[model samples]
Target chain A: MNAPAAQSVSPAPQQGGRPSPPALRFDNVTLGYDRHPAVHHLHLDIAPGSLTAIVGPNGAGKSTLLKAAAGLIRPLDGVIQRGVPARRIAYLPQAAALDNSFPLTVYDLVAMGLWERCGLFGRIGQRHAPRIAEALRAVGLTGLERRPIGALSGGQLQRALFARLLLQDAALILLDEPFNALDAATVADLTALIHRWRDEGRTVLAALHDLELVRASFPQTLLLARELIACGPTDVVLTDANLARARRMSEAPDPHAAPCVRAA
Target chain B: MHAIYAWLIGPFVEFDFLRRALVGALALSLSGAPVGVFLMLRRMSLTGDAMAHAILPGAAIGYLLYGLSLPAMTFGGLAAGFVVALLAGAVARLTQLREDASMAAFYLLSLALGVTIVSLRGSNVDLLHVLFGSVLALDDATLILLGAVAVITLFSLAALWRPLVVECVDPGFLRSVSRAGAPTHLIFLVLLVLNLVAGFHALGTLLAVGVIVLPAVSARFWARQVTGMAGVAIIVAALSGWLGLALSYHHGLPAGPAIILVAGGIYVLSLLLGRVGGLVWRALPGRHLEA
Candidate 1:
């Protein structure tokens, strides 16, 4: 399939005529478990206020990259620098990662987003009440505040999680498969919120599988297969050739192996 | 009214041992029950059981060394409990064995070592008292120790409340937000060891977990929220203590086992009749649909 033309190719220039620093920069970073690199030698920059989609086939290090950005895991070989402090970033793992059996109310779970401000000892001040209410209303979950999170349907749980993201109000947001298993209505609502965040000058990087959705909404894309295949404006980065290259690159065996590498 | 007074009030008013037993049991229930509630919530009930067993070798060593010295036994139990927990946690992290399996292995070894040590130094009577406890024989020193543990546990639990809840619900989220996660977990383990050591003085290691776990599990059937569950568990624990002391006074039953048996009875009853999610509620027509 032909890739769509880029709609917002260039970021708006600053008043001083200097390009803004990237919100996140990965310098030759390699991340893995048990010494098997899932993402290797990745040099990339996520520009401030940009909404970027990361897409590739299964096991393409999409989630690993997001975890590194969130500072949940350390890189084995290189560095990741964030313009904002780690607390100023919000990360939402795949819904499956959460234990729904936990007996927490929707209100309590969403209130966790305020932990950066309230901390372990501080009370949720009255000033935060309006914001929490607004976030819940924004996600269409105002009426479900008192209900247990386990009682929520999958779509409702996704909405509740989005409500939490709204509360986080982070400068940089990393979402891993946020729209997986979501119905069309929930996806549309969440997509509009993402657009609003971009309009508000917040940076968002989402790992997505739906190329059609990526082409429609994301102005930039990073195509990966365990390493960077392409990174640029969406239309230029997501060409048929790039995807085929990623697939072939992912399927091929490692040629840099020492003879004893397998044993190690 | 007379029968009630005779069965409950008369024992405590008439006998000094009964009053002391009641006080010690209440102190244990206050702190131990809440810990149990969290243990059950984290699905670490078996770990709590294992930790209790692990305390035995240390207490036995103390018994062997100091000849029933309360301070020595308490210190030894705390040290041994902490060591086993740390070793099990380390082994689980570094090896292919799951945490539960490692904890089980360590605790079993501790139990065997403890029984051997006790048998080496004392008679069968001494072993029986150590295994089942002498709730009626609590001295002023033991009472003071139990009270101190309760106070410290309550304060520490209050300070660690928010972080502990976050850790139990989603440890990864806790780690992502702040550096308090590991310390919060460590503090919780310390509290567990302290409460278990305190419990050993009254109910013995074998039966102390009953006071901690039974009431908490029973409360699970009745309360939907964490605080609510803890509150219910505390009440259940206190009630078992009082009723168990009464039965021991009037009927000449063993005090520790009586308390545990009372708590077990409540657990069974709550499983059938509790308001939150009892078997009876599930059995009722249309109740499942409503729930």
Candidate 2:
């Protein structure tokens, strides 16, 4: 029942001629509801140390693609190859996914990432302790460790999740809409955190909604709308043509928008 | 007075059963407190009710085979409860039915199955005892089993604590973070079922739930954090259990329900007087404080 986490690790250092494995690969991946496909022929590669944002309007399968990568929903076709098993992948889902009524502290919320390493019916170890503290510190949540999670603001909760991602010590991290309900300041702080993670040789794939923020922040893009509309550099892919195509895709359901320009 | 105090405290001061009842209450409180806190959050205290009922058929089977062996029956009951919960989970996921509907259905099915199983053995008296436990009948064997289950539940809770909390509050996001949320939650419910079954021998079905429920409910008014709530719950449960025993020694009412009632009374008191969850606090005097 636990969702598979997408990690924030680099192509794990390898020996011999095994070229560094792609951080994530969706090869001809067709994903959708039972028998009905949403996103099809989705061939995409996520390079290590790269921060790729999967952006599209609502119902665009942006969340779906991330879910497929995390192995939450079985892809209708194709495989989601990771450098290692799904365990090495750390995931930070959207803040909206959390129920605030749960009675736990910020510290308790972050501690769950270490459960897999704890072994079944096993005791916690000394080595993982420092990492937990370090992760919390990295998020600037050192003193708010024991604060009840329910009491935290949206930004604090998001940071707490980032701390959990840190606990995974993963080479790659997949985050879905992690900055949806944040203030401008929080968005900036989280953006800085993402940059820091990427600078540390980690790859971060996020599903972001803010177009300007996505353009300003992430260098890579995966423009999706029930399909892989475009996949490449932000500047290249966010061109008027692709943007118009994306806008057309967005207007598909509405039917009330102006006609999109097909640039040469 | 000295002689009377000796009679009151002597059994506890010397023999082990009296000591264990208190210890058992503490253990039950440790689990029940968090369970109560979560139940409040989820509004699924009813699930606890259904789970309590579900343990019956399993415990009845264990008892029919083992002749009141606490460990034997507890393990059986725990396993049965887990199966029922799994069935409920599957039903919720596969069908359009909500989790509450699944819980209600499972509760009735398991309760009936247990009664049918008990009738197969033709021991109405035994079933009644299991239904309403006589804690005085709980021997050292039951205590040991309770202790083991308690330890396992505690360790599991601690290990999965972080993800479980996150999952409970924000399962959608919890899903993306790591595959830690829902699995941890399933495992937690399994552990909860195990604890309830373990309490079956000493606490009975009805009172076991009450014990599991009220201490934490009462403690909620006093604490905001999980750790604080757990601490207060243990204290409340231990006190109630000890007080119930004393009251029972003086008046010949049943011990388990008496213990639960004491806890319920504490809950009532908290509701009236507590600054947080109590009823009247959100009204006149509360408004006056702000003014």
Candidate 3:
């Protein structure tokens, strides 16, 4: 069992001609729930300022990888190293994980993005109002400030979540299927936000199923099937051969499978 | 006006016990309703009920040891509720059982244990007092305890407001950004236990959740925001306390059940005619907002 060596390890040079260090690194990491490995022992390095798409079939380790990166799950083995502080990392879970039935206005929900700054007891002072408004406007949710989040359409709710993400001002953003069930317009709008984050030198990792979107926007890609299949430039990573392998590998997993003895 | 005054104001003015009950009810509502609102929002209303029952054995033990001592019962109940909550939460986390299932199991066991403990030595009347409570018999010490609990609950809630909302709405996101999520949740459980203990002193363990949950469920119909819901729940609970106390005084009804019944009636009314999303309002709608 050979560890898949990550291609594209050469990071883009920073302002002073120094190669910027990897923004994230997985050192022989294995992620799982209850010792049933959802993600196999693998190694990968994500460069700072890169927009990477993690593509995989259903039951693939895309979400598990993202959760581990977001510090929501501890690696069952090995380690995940992050370039930024935990507070400077933002995570947007799949829409289903959020409780929209909560009695909160759009304004209040979006304002929560300031948690890293305002903290538990800090006030959302007058100076922060403009940022919230700007985030809402950026996502085209300006007038819906007072509307309860439950009333927002699915696309509109995604937009509101994006607005919240914008206010997060994070260095590393982990989005778990940000465009699932969204219309084309909302996808385009959110994709543009992703591009803007890349342009601003923020690292963005999104797990997505849409291969075309990944080919179009994501420069780097990691194709996974409970284990890394291919990782490199999107065109090189999303080849027909790799896609077939991923589909085959992602078939119903055995819950009783024994642990791997091979070292990374 | 004279009859209204006689019916409403006369009870409090004429009787010290009525006045004490009124003050105790107001304090409980002021603090307990907000906690209830959050509990309802988090979909933990039944957990609140479970915790109410979970406190019974501790209070019973306190009764057996000290015989109706406020400090003994309050401390005992708090300790019991806290342990049960922690155990249930731990079981849910470490095992496959859900929190609700674990909580239900623990509370049922605690209730039976509490009853058996009390029935070992105390009379049926003592058991009834422990279960049903006597709000009219609140003493100076009990009133002070209620006031103190209310103050602590409000201040703690204000401080925990942000993290609590974040935790309820999107806990994964909160966990990503800060360490406040788990601590906020623990503190919220502490407050819930604290309030239930305070409420048990006035309404007894069986009826304690009445004030905590009934008004919160009713407030949902009237408000569309969390703060508004909390505010409305407080108002509803306070009003029910007043009206129920008065009705109990006049009719010789059991005070605790009377108070809970008033809250239940308000819930029904709110369900039908509340301003926000009531059945009647939704059924007969005339206005549309521009998109």
Q: Which number leads on TM-score?
A: 3
Query: What ranges in model 2 sit over 4 Å off?
Result: A1-21, A83-85, A110-143, A166-168, A250-264, B1-44, B59-80, B113-127, B140-148, B151-163, B166-187, B274-291
| Residue lDDT tens for model 3, A114-199 | 98888878899788999999999999898999998888999999998899889989999999999999999999999999999999
Q: Model 1's CAPRI class? A: medium
Q: Write the per-residue lDDT of candidate 2 for residues A1-264, one digit (tens) a residue.
A: 121222222233455676566778776677877545667567677877788888887878887787777778898777878765776677665555666665677876777667557633445556666877888998878989878777787788888887877776777788889888788887887789889888898888899888899889988888887666777778877888887787676423333534323121
Candidate 2 structure, TM-score to reference: 0.79
Candidate 1, residue B251: lDDT: 87
**Deviation of model 1 at A157, angstroms:** 1.4
lDDT (C-alpha, whole model) for all candidates: 0.87, 0.74, 0.90
Model 3 residue A7 lDDT? 46
Model 3, B195-284: lDDT tens digits are 999999899988989999999999999888888999999999999999999999999999999999999999999999999889998999
Scanning candidate 1 chain A in windows of ten residues, the lowest lDDT window is A1-10
Which residue pairs does candidate 1 place in steric collision? none
Clashing residue pairs for model 3: none
List the TM values for chain B, per candidate: 0.97, 0.89, 0.98
iRMSD (Å), candidate 3:
1.3
Ranking by TM-score: 3, 1, 2
Cα lDDT tens digits for candidate 2, B123-237: 7887778788767766777777777777887777677665555566767655654666668768778876876776677788766778777887787887776667767877788
Stretches of model 1 off by over 4 angstroms after superposition? A1-10, A13-16, A125-127, A251-256, A259-264, B287-291
Residues A1-264, candidate 1, lDDT per residue (tens digit)?
222222222345467778777899887677876567888677787889989999998888999999999998988777888989888999888763566776688888888889888888888767888988899999999888888877899999888888888888899999999999889899999999999999999999999999999999998999989878888789999999999988885543466744322211
